[model samples]
Target: MNAPAYAHPQATHTVPLGGARVAYLLVRSRRRSIGLEVGASGLTIRAPLRVSVAQIESALQEKAQWVLDKLAASALRVQQTPQVDWGQGAQLPYLGGLLTLQLHPAAPRGCELLAVGEGRWVLHVPLPVDALPASVRGQVHAWWLRHARLLLTQRLQRFAPDLGVQWRSLRLTNARTRWGSAKHDGGIMLNWRLLHFRLPVLDYVVVHELSHLRVMDHSPRFWAVVASVCPDYTRLRAELRQQPIPEWDL
Candidate 1:
């Protein structure tokens, strides 16, 4: 189950795992087992309220290798992911390419959506040349979110019919741990950050979610459904996993 947005870690602990020392936030909940999650925010541990600290550390030791490897990978991803510059000539990712930002403070009062050429998209922001980066980032982010809805919806429509499924709705998500998810009722939630990748990668995610509508689980049958529409799903999936998305501080 998803935790409440206001929930916070109860405590923090440092433990020796594998050959490294790791620090993790501990959240005591009513759950039956201890759960360890590593994401953009580092490591978090969720354990039952009745569990002892020793038991929790023991579990951490049992998964020492896995935890260490994931933490190291997360660090590497952080180092490789570029932070958006949010400047007049800053470049942004779009459709597997980059879009150069052009600030036009005196030109107009809002953003101008322009498509010049292939991989030559330009976002004209109506902000001063010396405007704060937060302001610039907000405008650009708003534009990307709006554009992602249209693009993702179109892609979903393009592949859903071919896959013999009709998505009830398309919901853009900002989830950190998943690219997309499909509900039994055909509601599709796709991460808007996927706009950073190429068209094929976005299409693969769309197809993957649609396939889940036909087969709820990732069994062989579900993979077959995905392969039907995306014969190169394996490669595209890998590309999506291996590629690093730009980190937006906004």
Candidate 2:
């Protein structure tokens, strides 16, 4: 595992495990046991308020191998991931292909679908050529949110009748860890970032969430429900996990 280049200001301690140095954010909470999470942001350690620093170090030492392995894996994933370039002429994934961004200062202040080509698209944004990346990113993000709502609604309406389930409401979400979620009250919340994926992947998520209306838990029966509607759900699910969405802050 590569050593953490920088640590969060809240990081309390640094520990050496083999050849790698792990700098983890130490969060003192009311929990009973220490928890270690290795994510895109690297290591985070959570412990009870009364736990001593030595105790925390000891606990981390005990799980040193596991922590290093997870960190290494996360580092590899980040290395392979693609980051979005918020500038003119930058390309981003849209419906399994790419969308080329074009800045049109004379046009409106928002983004407009200009044209579509073979396996690609042109998004005309009404921003000056020298617009700040932050401004461009914000406008593009807003546009994607609007389209995600419309397209997801259409997909739900198209598939819900076939599955014999009626969704009460649809809400767009920006959760970092979840793609979509369902409530027992027929409310469904899907991640707007899902616009990064293709239509079939989107449909799989929709069907998977609607299937919860019939079977709430992820048992074999629940999968059976999803498979009935999306027979290639297994493949689509893998693709959803393996494919990298462009990283962005907005």
Candidate 3:
């Protein structure tokens, strides 16, 4: 269940985001909230353990104007993202590379990369022109994620055995704020959109999460571990922060 939200126990802090007076509806729980995060996508009202719904809404109302404005801005950004046809000649970003669509009426209603160009790749799909964008995007995202995951696995497998660490499973994540995370049981969560970044950025993220196997927090020791494994990680680390994921409909 989504945890009930309440007034942040201590006090409320306010900040301005995008010329709007953004406020925090701090809802405290035994589990530190995922936290109030406003981004270009929208708002994610994270629920904390043992919080009250009334409090969350109360806070929501208190900042309704800010919420609406930010959400509207998010909507505009999404609107501004031009859409493409499901047919041939669609342009999409893939792993810091460009993918052009080449719709060929073949296969049992699935998709695949038809071929590669000198600096671009082609995604082939046999879907109707009016096909649902959500379904089309989901398929493309899944295909690329599978490919990226395979490559990521290949890279990490070489490093993991040396550290006596192994990942239980690998899956695509759609989280807005986090690029990757590691579980105590050796599970790893990675944003599928990481495929949009350059190789160094992707490597840094993979190493960052893998380093969590030894240390869980963003402490000095964790950085040391990350650096020890992936030297020149500092530059890539900064790059990941500055590089924004390209948003696609889904």
**Superposition TM-score, candidate 2 onto the true structure:** 0.74
- Write out the backbone clash pairs for model 3: 4-51, 4-52, 5-52, 8-26
lDDT string, candidate 2, 1-250, tens digits: 5554534345667888756777778988777778886666678888899999899989888898898887787778778878777889988888888888898787666678755776688888889888899998988888888889999999999999988999999999986546898989999999887877899999999999999998886779999999999999999997876687778764
| Per-residue lDDT over 37-122 for candidate 3, one digit per residue giving the tens place of the 0 to 100 score | 45543455666777675656566666766676656655565566555554447777666778886654673355677547655788
* Residue 119 lDDT, candidate 2, scale 0-100: 69
Best by TM-score: 1
Q: Residue by residue across 114-133, what tens digits does model 1's lDDT show?
A: 78887778888988888899
Clashes of each: 0, 0, 4
Question: All candidates' TM-scores?
Answer: 0.78, 0.74, 0.67
Q: How accurate is candidate 2 locally (lDDT)?
A: 0.83
lDDT of 2 at 206: 95
Native-to-model Cα distance after best TM-score fit, residue 135 in candidate 3, in Å: 4.5
